[model samples]
Target: MVELQAATKLDAVFHALGDATRRHMLRDLAGGERSVGELAAPFEISLAAASKHIKALERAGLVRRTVAGRKHLCRLEARPLEGAHEWLGFYKQFWSGRLDILESLLRQEDAAKSQGEDHD
Candidate 1:
């Protein structure tokens, strides 16, 4: 079903994002396109390792790689990230609401303590 495919895609995106190297690669690509060599430059990882990371990113739809003669150029493909962002947004809202309640409770506690001090 369409929902299942979407869930699978979301899983791939998160799996790609789960690695710090891949995340950094995405961040680097955000600035502009770069060759695999350039992406691999910042890390101590071997070229093959970098390729694996890029492959994971490609599978997640986070990066699009194009072959240019001898070099493979990569660029940020951010549309897939929307699903992740939307998913996280839900939690952000839920946490924000929970935090607001916690803040209110803390404020009420402080107020109660102040009142007790005044009575002493």
Candidate 2:
């Protein structure tokens, strides 16, 4: 059995998503369930290479697999990602306040520029 701390789950999710190939795989899985072949169709990599990336995602708990006959179907398991969202929410409020201040400063600058132009 595998378990991740709530605090550390975001780190795991972001680290697994750092790869371009894995990002593409995630986009495809977002549309619906897919087999490894369907997920690998757009890429030029070998099946073995794609499988390695999939394994990383599986370990991170972002993807779940169900084996049927000889095929494995991969589905998105997004509950783990809520940890990432919760982490980001903290920074969002801080940034929005900073951006609001910047917007006011910019407006003042623009008003001063227009006043100077009127004199010219």
Candidate 3:
């Protein structure tokens, strides 16, 4: 049951990350907390649309929102991304190993080809 819940949350986090706008918003927050308007300034999106993006990030635990008078400030909450990072790290290692093997094989092939050319 706990595993299932974790998987669900991971799904939500990926879903939130799947959008470019939300990803950029997270990048902006990484610098520091920003008001919704500040976040929206880089794009031509309406505040409502920006809020919707932010709400998705909130649901994924990627961003925390605090009310400051008229401003809705959002700060980056990166802990949830630890799961995603771990997941990607696994694949990164896998691919790195595969690429290393491929590089070695290619180098061997090139060495053989050079030797053959030297004989001719």
Top TM-score: which candidate number?
1
Candidates 2 and 3 compared: the better one by lDDT is 3
lDDT of 2 by residue, 1-120 (tens): 134575466677888889999989988999999999888889998888888889988977999989899887899988877877787888999999999999999999999999999999
Q: Candidate 2 — which pairs collide?
A: none
Tens digits of per-residue lDDT for model 3, 46-116: 99999999999999999999997898999999999999999899999999999999999999999999999
Residue 29 Cα positional deviation in candidate 1, in Å, after optimal superposition? 0.5
Model 3: which residue pairs collide? none
For all candidates in order, the CA lDDT equals: 0.97, 0.87, 0.97
- Score candidate 3 by TM-score against the native: 0.95
Provide the RMSD of all predictions against the true structure, rounded to 1 decimal.
0.7, 3.0, 1.0
lDDT of 2 at 3: 42
Per-candidate TM-score against the hidden true structure = 0.97, 0.84, 0.95
Task: Please write out the lDDT profile of model 1 over residues 27-91, one tens digit for every residue.
Answer: 99999999999999999999899999999999999999999899999999999999999999999
Candidate 2: which stretches are off by over 4 Å? 1-4, 114-120
For model 2, state the Cα shift of residue 80 in Å.
1.5
